[model samples]
Target: MARKPDTDKRIAVLGLGRFGGSLALELMRQRWEVIGVDANPAVVQGYADQLTHAAVANTTEETALRQLGITDLTHAVVGIGTDLEAGILTTSLLADLGVANIWAKAVSRQHARILERVGAHNVVLPEHEMGERVAHLVTGHILNFIEFEDDYALVKTRAPAEATDRTLADSELRTRYGVTVVSIKRPGENFTYATAGTTLYAGDILIVAGRTRDVEAFASLG
Candidate 1:
């Protein structure tokens, strides 16, 4: 996984709205130096004591950003949610300033595309992604679902009662369920990579990976 600079792992958050404010506070809690910037003075003051440095500045303007040492930070998040134009401008400025890791949040597909095109290293649609995850959780079929590109996912779920107490080879999951167990997580124990000899016990949790449909089918066994 990519990380911030080893010598000075400081991250700058542009925009002090709900998303950016929460991100900055979380970063601070994780012991990371954070510079919180916002065009609104009131918002900057709100987090002044909690953040390493909270300043009221217009990130959309290159001059204001340069004065705020925006380029000095190697990591940044452009969560200017309400203003697409400002979000795009901030992303562009951050890229031009050579910020290595730029994460931008967008409200819509079109907004996300624009941010990406303007040099956002990563674009996020939080609401949409959270909603999808919630939908999966509500099904109560899988313990957890991690979506990847397309409809593929990596899930952790309990072993079905009928399929317990048997070696992985005996379960015939690949043949019968069309899914593979990547690992097994026993209660209060670290996960162990799945092998043909591994046996599933009642309540054993399986870390599985495959298409979403295949994962669901596999989970249905439990």
Candidate 2:
């Protein structure tokens, strides 16, 4: 008898390139059963021992995917690089196979749009996102930053001089700076949720959220 698929934690990653390979390994570290698929026999052989299952198969073909039991998996990632046609076809095939969750990588805005139209549940432009993130980190005091689709951003940074030595309510951060401190971490202490009455001190770290420009301005304050 065939073992039933664990839809909750099992995933199929099609393409063993850098981004896909890294994501697969990390998912494995988190205890997910990962099936790595690629057309290159050498690539499959390289990851055969590391992944839960690795196979060399042309992912763009529906028959090939079915032969590999990809239809049984609930989640799939189309990580084909550069070959836009192949990536699109593979994503479409996964969608047709009734995979519940589909993630695909896009190299450009047009590619992202096409992937979405072709039934990709999620599309990521890794290089563009990484470039934006790196630009923020290098240009500001932010230790980390994540920007959303709506131009809002969440960032981690040290408490600015104006924000420290005062309660959040008294500081009037939202009124003055247009940003909200979501949480704070004092030296040697774990992070705690921030409240209006929460007081900030120098050297404390803060998790803040606001419009991207507002957050950047607030972090720039000395």
Candidate 3:
């Protein structure tokens, strides 16, 4: 009997390399049913016990994907590394299969463009993004950074000296610096939402949101 697809919180990950394997494990940790697929039998075997289902198949072939019931899966991630042809073929096949959400890994700008053109709903350049994030962390006081479209970013960093000992309204961070401290965490206590009347203390960790340049300038303040 053909297994009925469980759309809710179920995902298929193709290519069980470092990126795909890590993603599949994390999804499992989050309580998602993950179907892991890899062309290499050894890779599939290693993850068989960890995932909901692990299979050895060439995802680039439509017949192979059909045999694994990939068409029934609403979400799929093509984590194929280095193999541009396989990645593109798999993404194209998934799109033709009518998978609603297709996320693919790209090795370069051209690869990303082609993936988008071929029908990858989302393309991630993990190495590029990680390198950019590391650059921000090492060059500034930013403890963590998440960049969004249009140069906007949310960052975690220590409260600047000017912001310490003053309420959020008094500091005029939004007006003067064009950045808003959304939340703060003191040394021992948990993070709390930042309000106009909330006073910041020295060494408090702040989660700030603003344009990239504005956030950088705010983090640079003494």
**Candidate closest to the true structure, highest TM-score:** 2
Off by over 4 Å in 3: 1-7
- What's the residue-level lDDT of 162 in candidate 1? 74
Q: Give the clashing pairs for model 2.
A: none
The candidate with the higher TM-score, 1 or 3, is: 3
Single out the weakest 10-residue window by summed lDDT for candidate 2. Answer: 1-10
Indicate the residue-level lDDT of 65 in model 3.
Answer: 90
Pairs of residues clashing in candidate 1: 160-222
Model 1 accuracy (lDDT, Cα): 0.87
In candidate 1, what are the lDDT values of residues 37-129, reduced to their tens digit? 998898899999999999998888889888888777788899899888888999998888788889999999999888989899888898988
Please, what are the lDDT tens digits per residue for candidate 3 over residues 162-188? 788999999899999999999999999
TM-scores of all candidate predictions against the true structure? 0.90, 0.95, 0.94
* CA lDDT for candidate 3: 0.92
